[model samples]
Target: MNAPRLIVGLGNPTDQHASDRHNAGFWFIDALLRHYPGQMRPDTKFFGDVGEVRIGTQVVRLIKPMTYMNRSGQAVGALARFYRIDPEDILVAYDELDLMPGSARLKLGGSSTHNGLRDLTAHLGTPRYWRLRLGIGHPRTLNPGQSVINFVLGRPSAADQQLIEQAIDRSVDHLPVLFRDGWEIATQQLHSADPAMQAKKEAKSSNPKEEAGEKARRRAPEDA
Candidate 1:
């Protein structure tokens, strides 16, 4: 059998950080657990709780590093080494300030000013891991002295929290599809606007009178 894949959710482990914007990664994992219970349990060696679940014939391990966001690499590194899993097989989920709320993007790439990813690359010595980035829009204005930290660590307003939670739910639903199908197919299914697509199809099936009127308008100009 193939070695299990690791899905690590990056976040700080503290009551204070539980609902913070920076902890969106953990929020996703929490939502996943709610959807599929009894798949994970606490494992102290990883410096966090670890859970295992089977999707088809493949077993995927879910991890939440206990170390604070900046030091997440340590816990992840330890888990990867113990499991003998390659970096490419590891999937990480985290929040991205550049993306708008209630939106998410999945890609495999290098760290981009993301402290968690930076430290992770430093420990793993590679930047080839998969990532699911949850969007948490940037603050309207900048503040001095650890402003970035404050912005990420702060709790979101009620409306923003609702949006983030909705995104999390969608992300969790997409995970099973991701494992069952490939990324491209799963992404389209998850991100595509179904209602908008239906509307477009309906518009194409306009009344016969409207189509006839449009044809008459075109022919009138030619006749003149």
Candidate 2:
């Protein structure tokens, strides 16, 4: 697969949403700017802040849509069309509620519940673009009574934010590999680096008989 040429980070505009969990994408972009030699400038034409950075031989463009989260497509589509960039050459990073904090996943061509992504797809006319799902966690799992809108628009707890920051840093570090080595190698490297995921895998790999015995005991009460 071709490496991405344009990377869009989905988030709301303004200082108000800066630290919100919904701005995880913006946080990733900030982290990327720290790692790469680039500076963002406001581009009225694209309706967002745009920047460029060299990743090895390729020149990659970065965008943080100022159109806010729900209408992010307005900015992304403008940039993509002007550059003649194919959907395959675009990668969008945004928050994911389904994933736990500190965990991230990279995938291509899938539907999402995110309004930002949905609007993006409408503009691009395809869902084939790559996506970097940064986990901010879901309210349903983290706080049973909280609504998703409030949870995402709100800031994460300090502990959760720390984990999310680590994930962002890891993702940003993997971009060079993604640009030079391609998706498979980059994805594997990124996913493997997630400590929480590794721990879960290790737990699952423990003694099967012991695990089975525990499951059996739990089921015994139901069976009785």
Candidate 3:
């Protein structure tokens, strides 16, 4: 597979949404800009903030949709269609509620209950693109009776935010592997470094109650 030509960070584009868990994608993009020499500027044609950075030999375009979370695809679709970039060569980074904070996954396909991803697939016409699922964790798992909408739109706790930021850094560090090597190797390298995933595995193996809680958490609805 070709190295990704476009890397999109899915998030609502407003100051109000900046620290929300739903803006994990934006946070990742910000982190990337810090590590790689790049600047984000608003582009009307793309309906988003667009930028680029060279990784190895690949010039990867980065986008942060200016549209709200539900309409995320509009900006992505505009930029992607104009560039004639194939869906397979696009990577989108967004938050995930299923995994615990401090864990992230790189994978292709599967939108699950993520509205941003669902809209992205609708516009891109396929779910074949790569994804960086930065785990924000579910409210039901962390705090009982909290609504999904409130949980996602609200800022994460200080400790959780630290974990999420750590996860973002880890994901950013492995981009070279994803672009230079391939999905299989990158997935192995990325997943192997996820401490949260390892902790979850240990909890599942040693504590049935914790495993059951995890299952319930997955089954809970993510949208309001």
Candidate 1 yields a Cα-based lDDT of 0.79
How close to the true structure is residue 90 of candidate 1, measured as C-alpha lDDT?
89
Error of 3 at 22 (Å): 0.3
Highest TM-score: give the candidate number. 2
Q: Write the per-residue lDDT of candidate 1 for residues 1-224, one digit (tens) a residue.
A: 12229888888887978888999998888887787754556677887779876666677888998888898898899999998889878889999888767777777776589999999998898998888888887875432354777889988778778878888888788877787777777667766533333454467467777767767898998899
Q: For candidate 2, lDDT tens digit of each residue in 1-224?
A: 99999988889998999999999999988888888899999999999999998888999999999998989999999999999999999989899999999988899988888999999999999999999999988998898899999999999999999999999998988988998899999999999998877886688669687678778998998999
Each model's Cα RMSD: 7.9, 5.6, 7.0
Score every model by TM-score.
Answer: 0.79, 0.91, 0.88
**Candidate 3 lDDT, 127-223, residue by residue in tens:** 8999999999998898789999999999999999999999999999999998889888989999989996677688697989888888789878873
Report every candidate's CA lDDT: 0.79, 0.92, 0.91
Superposed model 2: Cα runs more than 4 Å off: 209-224
Residues forming the 10-long window of minimal summed lDDT in candidate 1: 192-201
TM-score winner between 2 and 3, please give it.
2
Candidates sorted by TM-score, best first? 2, 3, 1
Candidate 1 residue runs with Cα over 4 Å from true position: 1-4, 141-146, 193-224
The full ranking of all candidates by lDDT, starting with the best, is 2, 3, 1
lDDT for residue 155 in candidate 1, whole number 0-100: 84
